[model samples]
Target: MSSSHPTPQPWYKQFWPWFLIGLLLSSIAVSTSFAVLSIRSFDGMVQEDYYEHGKAINMVLAKQQQAADLNLGATLRIDPLTSDAVLDLTGDDRPERLVLKLIFPTEADRDHELRLEHVRDGRYLGQAPDNLRYRWYLQLQPDQETPTWRLVGEGRFPDEGEFALTPGRAADS
Candidate 1:
């Protein structure tokens, strides 16, 4: 009689265990590759060019700071007259000349510019232009800066003390 056939091996010993191990290894490798690719893309977005842009913006802000530093401790007082206007100025130091600028909130509003004429007793006088309205600013700049006084107050009318200009209201008569 023929010998009994060898017992068939269980499916786990024959192939199933190795198949499961291969599947687990392949899935791990794919996941690792995906994570690596994502990290590389994120780093590429933050380049030196982005830093340069930020520095350029900072430079512009510094220039504005320098301009503001040019004026300090300047006082402007406005006195409205029937025809002409008088501006009295007082501070630690005096400026060679004062600039009066009229600003309009909108294009429809009128704007005017006037140079203050210095008079005795630390006073400046100028003629008020017609059709001026809404808001005005008086800026004072000293001839020198060693004493630490550079620019006086801004958006101030000589007659009115520290008055904010509203859009609809006339800043200076």
Candidate 2:
């Protein structure tokens, strides 16, 4: 009897089929890698006590109003070389020790607070971060509770200049 032809091979064994499968797999691998990278680098900083903050909004506004009533303001200067922060107060009266809070917009760990010492009349001095840049929310207060005012501004380091901090009104927004 005549020899029978070999049975046709399955489609999976063919070169084109394997090549297409590999191409799809490679695309999936690339997309998955990008997704992982984005997740790891995301800076999603949210306040843990958002509810409390929301509840205390009225009090915060009241404090702002208090600052307005007192007509308090200041001029802030940071020396890049010495990392020294100076505040010149312009108001009716000054507190014994003014609290300077440098709050990072997105990173809570980068937030810093300095209890500025009153060097002279309407002048306060404290140590600031050496390498501070980008936008920052500044809160100048005497204590943790009431009598607080917020000043939002951007810090352009390595440049010798001064920034204004007026109470009851945000510098940037």
Candidate 3:
């Protein structure tokens, strides 16, 4: 007597093999999407001239020390309606024009510099864009190509609209 045996199904038709293959393919697809995203998005967090920036740290500290030596303090106020900015700077020597630097914490493109003309004794006037509604790193400097001193402050803008700056606050430590 002769006995007949049935043939087994191929691996492609097996459940475990297809399940494993599906998992591998899914992983590959996910990794490809993440790679594309990283390639397309440019986060502006890295500086090209990191060495130069490091070298400038000493100069910034010197400027801060100069501001402290001058005993500088200021109160900055902004008008919500007219988008006007006024600063009352207290120090021994005041400049004819002041440079107000508004630096956004995360977005470099949102940084702004406004030149405030000296209106009168200790009063400086400038116009700010009405769209500044976020927090900023503020720096007050003489309107020069290279500022010798700077009064640094930080505050959430438009909501409070008024802030004080002093050389004692670590000068943007």
Number of backbone collisions per candidate:
9, 0, 0
Candidate closer to the true structure by lDDT (higher is better), 1 or 3: 3
Better by TM-score, candidate 2 or 1: 2
TM-score to true structure, per model = 0.37, 0.78, 0.89
Flag regions of model 3 displaced more than 4 Å: 168-173
- Deviating ranges (above 4 Å) for candidate 2: 1-7, 10-12, 31-35, 42-45, 144-154
Q: Report the C-alpha lDDT of model 1 over 53-131, residue by residue, as the tens digit.
A: 8887555444334444432232344444443655655533345555555544443236565677677665767676743
Put down candidate 3 lDDT per residue, 1-173, tens digits, no spaces: 88888889998888999899999999999999999999898686577889999999889889878998998888888887787999999988699999998888888889999999998999999998886786788889899888889888886766535687776442321
Relative to the unseen true structure, what is the C-alpha lDDT of residue 64 in candidate 2, on a scale of 0 to 100? 69
**Local accuracy of candidate 2 as per-residue lDDT tens digits, 33-105:** 9999999998664756889989998877777677767787788888878989998887776877888888887
Against the reference, the lDDT scores of all candidates come to 0.49, 0.77, 0.84
Q: Please report the candidate that would top lDDT against the real structure.
A: 3
Q: Give me candidate 2's TM-score against the actual structure.
A: 0.78
lDDT of 3: 0.84
Number of the top-ranking candidate, with TM-score as the measure: 3
User: C-alpha displacement of 71 in model 1, angstroms?
Assistant: 9.3
Error of 3 at 9 (Å): 2.3
Lowest summed-lDDT stretch of 10 residues in model 3?
164-173
